[model samples]
Target: MKFMMTFHWVPDTEQRAEAIERFLRTGGVPPQGVQLLGRWTSADLGSGFDLLETDDAAKLTEFAYQWSDLMELEIMPVLEDAELAAVFGRVAKK
Candidate 1:
């Protein structure tokens, strides 16, 4: 039960940053089994990329909700190598 968490801001930079910072400090999200992966933010500088590993859907859902309430956010699954290969199948012959 892996979950990917994304953040999309629906407010001004200052407000957004404040929310994010607060989340980081008190979100209750587990620090173990999570990776930062990669991130990109050209505006507001209030964005991050996180790779989360959890087997409990309930916990993951709570984590997502916490982020959503903090800032306008979006999250989606990022499959692992095996999962990605299974979904995409073999590469086309060239």
Candidate 2:
């Protein structure tokens, strides 16, 4: 499954800096079983979004735990456009 992880950094500058430094030090590696497909950050640096693929949701939590201290995270399951259309079609038929 694919998931969209939204990260909203705390308003504190020091905490945000610490989070960035930690990530840099660790090479910004994603948790096991989680493949980071892409990422985009807000121009203001207040928040960012990551597209990740993983079969095990547990692995997603591992990634979240690493940065939870400095940022608020929201993980949402997502599907491609065709997949969503197919789902809607199935539901409509029922």
lDDT of each: 0.62, 0.90
- Off-target runs (Cα >4 Å) in candidate 1 are 20-24, 31-43, 86-94
- Tell me how candidate 2 scores on lDDT: 0.90
RMSD of each: 4.2, 1.4
**Which candidate wins on lDDT?**
2
* Model 2 pairs in collision: none
List, in order, the clash count of every candidate structure.
1, 0
lDDT of 1: 0.62
**Model 2 Cα shift for residue 80 (angstroms):** 0.8
Give one digit per residue, the lDDT tens place, for model 1 in 1-94: 4456666666576777777688678754544445345455547555654566766666666666756665665667678888877766766353
